[model samples]
Target: MAIEEKRAWIMAVVTIVAYGTYLALVLNAAAGAPLGEAPYVYAMLWTIGGAIVAAILLNILAAIVSPRDGGKKDQRDKEINRLGEHIGQSFVILGAVLALLFAITGLAAFWIANVIYLAFVLSSILGSIAKIVAYRRGFQSW
Candidate 1:
């Protein structure tokens, strides 16, 4: 697999695991209280930070493992990346709209924040999946 593809896989898996970990911690801490009342800000921040660190570390590991790839990016890589980003960004818009609706409806800040965070996570996963699929199945030029 190309180094980019490997990186995509790493991103997807790491995002899922980090977010899952955060969700578990937050939900456990809620302890039957309303989700809005749970201490989520710290957990979300920590998980986001941890995910960034882990992604950097794992990317370094991936590079070391495949020194021959040398983290090169050609035309195909660029195109695939653009396509993946285009596909993934839809969720961000969706999330923003939903958050706006929540705000207008007087929903808790917690819900708004969580919705935005979930959108980011979804974007990352979908983007990575698109890149991986393009790498494996060949990107179409249209």
Candidate 2:
């Protein structure tokens, strides 16, 4: 697989794992209380930070394992990356709009934060999936 494809896989896996970990931590802390009452800021921050570190480390490892393939990108790779980013960016806009509405309605910070976080997670996963699909199924740039 190309390094970019491997990167997509790494991103998807790391994002999913980190988000799952965050949810589990928050839910467990909530116990029987409201989700908003749970201490989530620290958990969310830690998980996001961990995911970034993990993705970077994994990408480094991949490059170490395949030095020749590292840092190699052609027209197809660039185009597919652009396409995947465009596809993923939709979630970001949706999240921002939802957060704005929630804030305007005076919703709990928890809800707004979670919405944004989920949107980012979904964006990463979907973008990674799109990139992987393009690589595996052949991409055609218009």
Error of 2 at 128 (Å): 0.4
lDDT of 1: 0.94
Q: Which residue pairs collide in model 2, if any? A: none
Listed in order, each prediction's TM-score against the native is 0.96, 0.98
Local accuracy of candidate 2 as per-residue lDDT tens digits, 65-123: 99889679998889999999999999999999999999999999999999999999999
Model 2 spans > 4 angstroms off: none
Candidate 2 root-mean-square deviation in Å: 0.7
State each candidate's clash count: 0, 0
lDDT of 1 by residue, 52-118 (tens): 9999999999999999999998989899999989989999999999999999999999999999999
